[model samples]
Target: MTQQPHLFCFGLGYTALALARVLKQQGWRVTGTCRSTSNTEEARALGLEIVIFDPDHPVEGLAQRLAGVTHLLSSVPPGAAGDPVLQAHGATLAEAAPRLKWIGYLSTTGVYGDRQGGWVDEQSPLTPSGERGQRRLDAETAWLALPQPAHLFRLAGIYGPGRSVLDTIRAGKARRVLKPGQVFSRIHRDDIVQILLASFAHPNPGAAYNACDDDAADPAEVTAYACKLLNVAPPPEVPFAEAALSPMARSFYDDNKRVRNDRIKRELGVTLKYPDYRAGLTALLATESATSSSTTA
Candidate 1:
């Protein structure tokens, strides 16, 4: 009897949840770790197997849980002490590397740091500007060092479904922050899932791919587009310097670059479903409206 495909994700966050849901629908056994009991319950409600895990709270018997897991994906970000998964289960993973077909580590475009609106691809020098970016870069190195070849996905800003700017606007917190010569690369969550699925089809270990859309536009442009889709007036624009953004939110402005995703297309044979903010926001609005109609019916 042929063995079924089984995917084990290190962290069942937004992106991982999306990928796991798709794989589960296609008959793959999916299991992963969340950070909290509430998230575990919510994920289980969606027919996913999730256990709580973190740096201090490691999952017991992770090795036994991961038995027969053909594919592995880690979306956990490194903390001050480093990657929680590796810190806790590196030995087990190294021991199991021989049987695992593929391992993917979800990194960030922040590893590329600020580029002054310049473009960067997979070959770009990693010069992360902050402590968070540095942590991600370090974690990528650790994952690649494992005996099992690991694929690194440097993802740009992710938004989709209930997580996009549409939610921000509806919640009355949308803002158009203008920064001269500043641009950000963003990928819709669905596009990220497609890239992951494509990579699974074309398994190339020791490969690093930039996961983002072809369009790199300003935040203000994306916000304006989302407002247009919602049929609401765009909020007054605020200069980046005076936006009064929280320290964490303000940190996002430290990077300015157009991330090139040609590698995923050229090597993995992948195409983006929503190539730009306009298309993504439009589709999100349509989906939300359809869901609302169904609920009302």
Candidate 2:
């Protein structure tokens, strides 16, 4: 009899849980960790096998729990103290390296920081503009240093489903900040899942792939498009300098790079379902309409 595939996730957040659910439906055993008690309960409610894990509270008997895990994914971001998962369980992972078929580390395109509206592919040198990006770069280095072939996915701005410009408009919080020549790369959440699935099938260890759509568009343009889709008047354009954005939101504008995702297509033989924002947004709107109609029926 063939051995059953098992996947262990370090942080079962939005994207990780999305992947976990798909694999579970396909007969893969999925187990993972969540930091808080509420999240633990919620994941359990979703039929997930979850455990509490954080810097202060590490999972007991983690090595044993990971015994049959054929695949590993870490979606946890590195903080000032570095990667919480790596800090807590690096040794256990190294010891179990041989048995793990594939290991994936979720990184960010922020690692290529401040590209000045230039383009960057997977091979571009990592020069993060901010502390957050640097921390992720450090975590990527540590993960790649492991004996196992760790695949690194450098993702761009992730938006989909309940979290997109469409939702922003409905909440009456839409803003179109005017910053000319500044563009961002983004991927739908489902597309991100698809990339991960494709990588699982291809399994090229030690490779870094850029996970983004074909479009590198201005934020204002995206906002306008969303408004059009909803038939709402576009919000007044606020000059980027005059916009009262929180520090965290302001930080995102620091990077101006268009990421290239050719490697994923060339190597993984994967075609993105939504190749750009237009396609992604249209599909999202259609889905939302269908859901609302079905609920009312």
Candidate 3:
């Protein structure tokens, strides 16, 4: 009998869960860690095993459960003390994960930081302009240093169902905060999931790929497009200085760089379902409408 693939995710959040759904269709056994089991009823219904996990609070006997794992992926961000998974179990995974073939660390494009709205590829300099970017860069380095074929995916802004500009506009909170020459790159959630699966199909140890769409567009442009689709007026433009945004939200505008995703296409031989926000938003709207219709019926 042929052994089936088993994937263990360190943080089963949006991106990881999306990948898990795809892998499940291929007869893969999926298990992951989350902050709480209480919120995992939906995940459990999908045949996933979710364990309560927090960096500050380690789960006992997790090491014993990692046998026969064929792949590992982490969507957990690094905290003040560094990446929670690597810091806690890097050594053990390296030594004991006998079946492990590929390991992936989900990183951010912020590590290339504030390129004056210029373009950045995988070979771009690691000059992060913010703490979040810097921490991700450090985490990328540490994960690569492990005794394994650890790959890094530096992702752009992630947006998808229940989390896109559509949701913001529906809640009447969509604002086109103006920051001149500030362009941002983004990836749909499903695209990120596809990239994860593609990497598994073609493993290149110590490789770094920028995961984003074909276009690096302006925030206002995307909002206007979403509003157009919904037949609602786009929120009036607000200057960045005048906009009432939290520190963290404001910090997003701090970095301005267009990420290039040539590597994923070149190496992984993958094509993106949503090449830009226009395609992604249209699909999300359709998906929402379908779900709404099903629920009402």
Candidate 4:
């Protein structure tokens, strides 16, 4: 008898929930771990069986949970203690890994560090400017060293649905920050799922891929475009030097690089649903319109 597809996500964040939704529709069994009981409630609303799992504080029954898991994906970020998933439950996963088809670790393009606004592929050097990026690099290494097939998806700025510049604009927090020659790569959340789904069909273990849209664009342009979509005037551009951002926020601007998504295309054959910010924002605005009308009606 052929085994059924089962996905066990370590952290059921926004992205994981989206993937679970599609997999459930495709007749796959899905289960996941969330940080808190409150998030577990939200996961249940998505029709997923979720357990309270805070890797920082250890939990039991992880071994039992791994029993029937055929595939695994971890979206959990690393911390000072390193990867919470590996530190807490690496042994159980290693035991279950041989039979598993694929394991994907959602890493950050920050792992590539500051590339002087240049371009980086999957094989770029891992020299992160901050401790957070270093931790992710460590986590990626640990996951890949596992005896199972593991794929690393180094993702750029992720935006979609309620988390895009559109939301920021509507919430009265939008800023047109201008730093000349500073371009950042962003990927739509839906496109991220599609890339993963495509990889699932191909199943290349020990492979690393960069996940980002074709357009590596200026933030000011994105801000102006969002305002255009909403029929609002764009905010005045604030030069990056005068923005007075927090250290964490400033750290983001330290790294500048355009990511190449050719591997996902050449290897997994993915054609991004939103190839650029313009396409993504237009589609999201349309969805917002339809959803608002339906809810009001």
215 Cα displacement, candidate 2 (Å): 0.1
lDDT of 2 by residue, 1-297 (tens): 898999889899889888887887899888899998777765676677888898889888989998888999999999899999889999999888778989999999999989899999988989999999999999999999888858999999999889999999999999999999999999989988989999999998899999999999999999999999999999999999999999999999999999999999999988999999999999999999999999999
Q: Write the residue-wise lDDT of candidate 1 on 37-132 in tens digits.
A: 877765786687787788888888888988889999999999999988899999999888778888999999999999999999999999999999
The 10-residue segment with the lowest total lDDT in model 1: 37-46
* Candidate 3 clash pair list: none
lDDT (Cα atoms) of all candidates against the true structure: 0.91, 0.92, 0.89, 0.90
* lDDT for 228 (candidate 2): 95
lDDT accuracy of residue 1 in candidate 1:
91
The weakest ten consecutive residues by lDDT in model 3 span 90-99
Residue pairs in collision within model 1:
none
Top-TM-score structure, candidate number: 2
Better of 1 and 2 by TM-score: 2
Compose the digit string of candidate 3's lDDT tens values, residues 11-57.
88888888888889989999898888677876787799787778877
TM-score of each: 0.97, 0.98, 0.96, 0.97
Cα lDDT, model 2, residue 278: 94
Q: Give the C-alpha lDDT of model 2.
A: 0.92
lDDT of 4 by residue, 85-153 (tens): 889888888888888888999999999999888999998788998899999999999999889858999
